[model samples]
Target: MTTNEETIVMTPLWLAIEENLLALEGQNITEENKEKTVQKLVGELDGKGYAVSKSGIKMMALRWALEDMLKVGRPMLKDLTKALSELTLEDLANPCHASYRVTDNLGKTWERVQKTDRRDALIQMFEEAKLDLLVQKAKGLDGDLGIRLLIEETVESPVILERMGIPQEKLDQVHADIAAEIAARNKVLSLLETVEGKPDHEKVKFLFSNDIPEDLIIEVAQIAQADIDKAKKAMEEELKEQQRLAEEAAAKKKAEAEGPALEDIPMDQMAEHIYAIREIQYFSDVEKEIRTMCEQSAIPKAIVDLSFSDPDKFDELEKQCEG
Candidate 1:
């Protein structure tokens, strides 16, 4: 091969990866896109007279991405490590502050937060943790080998094997596992749909809430011959509009039912009507409003007094009223 020809032929798959990344513009990773990327790499390599397998090229591209992540994440990882080491047990147990700070690739700083009960310090640093460990281990290896290591060491499933073109040793076993996973996923879908009487929009929301795979929702829709676009539109747009309309209708109904302004009512009539408060179907979330209305009116003094004397009872009433 001529010098230019050899250079072109030897060019790494990272170039293709960079192009794909640029095209994606930081979009969420998807299996379809990844497959298309591999096919594109295959075509590009073919055009350059390089006879590389799609799987092999994919592995190289994956490694390149990981390498970049590791490089960028190292500083963040170090900062996190230092901060974590310095943290006292009490800080981990119950943080008083809203958030702490960390520096990123651009030397721009951002706060790391752990929300009450819902988020943990370690959980918030997951990206940094994953990149730090994987990159540190793969740094010494070549692109293909590094990606192989990542696949082996990580919790990522057999789909990675298919993507990397790594042959499954127990092919039948792999098939069985895949079948089981699909069955389990289907069971989840059925339970969410049939048992719960949830429509596709709500079902999709449930799946998303559980962090179930988007592909599974797509698959479920396909199996049922449901229009995925319509289901998505209902969840994203139609359902939201319906909810908004319902809220507006409820507000209108409430206003109409409120009868006359309290100012228009005679004090004796208002006192007589205040007995209707005892018939409240459930406790209300409008705590401040309830408190003010009760406090200013002598007729509802019992409810206001209950808020101070037996606050737990009032709290229980509030809990029971939740939708």
Candidate 2:
């Protein structure tokens, strides 16, 4: 591209002129204000770094505006035209217009046009408004901001759909769809509220999984209240019994690990134990163990050694073993 084509110069004077000239577009000028208008244009261009004639300023502004229109407004115009053309005369005549009515000099009025009209009068106004808004944004703005202005106007068909119009049949379908959604939401809400007060029982879970209605679940919950209570009490009792068994077992194990104490037994029985320890291989050192037993029982060594060496000599040993 040429340097002039590649670069954009946005000095205050050219911008002011461009803005003023754009504001004058689509006006029906009369001879009375013609000279005044030209003078105003000349005055706006007078105080700039460079001097330019009134005609020159007007030409450049118009060119810039036109270029912007082609680059941005044309695509938007095409899309909106498509949006408008989609509407039938039936859509335009829908009493719904009372809601979207555009008001003006005559008060609130809805325009009704024939299906075969050569031009859609309102579309022209819509296009011009959108076009002017985009052109305003194009001034001294570039990249995403300028591009965004255009993109924003090019809204998808899903939005502004009322402007494009929909048939009564499609409206009915939408109504049915909305009803279904609301009903499903209500069911889910009811289920959620119901489940919160209920237990995580398999029966309740099964009922929910099968999509049983809330009223039925409420009735079942009433019948199962006693059963649920019974089940919970039974579970707690079972856990307590298990804990009792564990404690009893632990006590038994501790008692078994610790043999009978010397003070807790009589001398004769202690003598018999020492005799039994002699016969059993449980004592790592039999002689030392017998001595410890003799001292703990306060029995004489001679007596213990005799009893441990000859179990038959202890008369009580036979009866105790039998017992």
Candidate 3:
């Protein structure tokens, strides 16, 4: 073959490793034989095209090197290394903090290298070495290996849920609900702070109070009355119009069906009707609990005095008592 043709056909030492290994597999090779063979393979790959210096070979070797470091790394970092070794694509894309990202990437690269042939075998060499010693040495430098060890030692350890008495599903839902409620209430509470005074904070604290606050009756009434007045005004107008039409239609239908005019229909009393219905069923369990809590709790006698006599004076208290 011509020099150019020979050069093209000749596989580099790294490239020829597979062919050589396949040839060696048929022979009876022991531990000593395997070592000599690896040395020979390295020399041949180095001789042909100086494969060790090539980018592909260097990349492959670097990967193998990282894996070796992991297997022999210190005990403290062993868990971190194992965790890193198991990372998937989803793990890589997650928006983790920056330092964690670096450690994850190093683990991913090592895993990928371990899957390749020459690189895989090279890694085994290090895994068989004194891994704990290598890891100890690694912690001395701020390399990928060192960061991994540090992370392993410092990361918050996972608590076993079973031991903590938390069901996994319950824990997950609690996390999600807390996140959602916090987001939703943050803005409302912020506005309450700016527009209203710290009354909201006090109200929150007193919400479950056994003994209602001395001022609770007056405060609840003032707030509820304002809200009720606005709602009543709007709802009354709408309900009146609806009632007027219903009365006229009922009269017309009844007169036609009976062959005589129905007596003047009573004016719709929907607003009062709705208020009565609402007032009948208002007190919540929370309110009842608070009322019953009077034994050990200091309930403002003023609120208790007003609530028992005419709860309607405070709309929510009325609802809680009635509901």
Candidate 4:
């Protein structure tokens, strides 16, 4: 029922100093670095957005002032540090309240604990690094970028994980889970690369996982079939081009030849030259029709089939398919 104004209390400097002094009281300190440490603490607090009023600054500077204060200050702050240290499934259920109890670290509850561990460990890492910061980053990044950053950071960090206190078995599970995810991602990227244009949902899913909509599956299959058709047509056109070039080369050679004096020319040689010319002319005609068919569809199935069966008669086949 408390409003923000009613609930929010300016953290007193005496309280801040009391907490710091208690933590440092256990440490054996030399007097030479006391001022330097105090200055550093103030700077860190300021950087963290704690307002440094004159009273707050002076209270922080005075060690006796910190010592004289009742140690029964905010238990919430100590709880926050402990929460960060032994964060677990149980502790997560507690809202910020006086009666709420924190949980101890627990054991695994799943068969694929490795995958579960990686995500769980990453969550702990995110909590340590500051969930609020992650939320800010997620908000700043568009959906894809945010997801990418989250995955990359989770996969990379080691320090925050040391505090996670996950068992060896869970650690092993994390590694396996990360490897599986990396492999899946690579497969998705590979499939995306094969697509000439913007990738569709079906192709992405097919490449990455077995899950796909019936409509998307049908669409991808059609795309693959079309690609096959294009390849066939390209092959046919290339064959035709090769034939044309060969004929042209042969014609040039024949024109330049002395012809072995027409009377002396062998019958076989004459027949071979005639055959080369006819073949060249046939391919040239086929090449034109193939180009036309490519304009209609990258993988015109009927055209491709005809081109595969009788390349020399591709023009006639293409005309028949078009008709």
lDDT of 4 by residue, 111-172 (tens): 12123323433344335445434434644775345434444556333432343433556555
| Residue pairs in collision within model 4 | 114-173, 114-174
Q: What CA root-mean-square deviation does each model show from the true structure?
A: 29.9, 18.3, 23.7, 20.0
Task: Residues 256-275, candidate 2: write the lDDT tens digits.
Answer: 44545534657676657656
Q: Per-residue CA lDDT of candidate 1, range 72-117, in tens?
A: 5332334445665554433433232312332232234312222233
* Residue pairs in clash, model 2: none
> Which candidate, 1 or 3, has the higher TM-score?
1
Model 4 spans > 4 angstroms off: 1-17, 20-60, 63-164, 198-323
Better of 3 and 4 by lDDT: 4
Candidate 1 displacement at residue 101 in angstroms: 66
Report lDDT (Cα) of residue 300, candidate 3: 34
lDDT against the true structure, each candidate: 0.50, 0.48, 0.43, 0.45
lDDT of 2 at 38: 56
Q: Give the runs in model 3 whose Cα sits over 4 Å from its true position.
A: 1-80, 83-245, 252-323
Instruction: Name the weakest run of 10 consecutive residues (lDDT summed) in model 2.
Output: 105-114
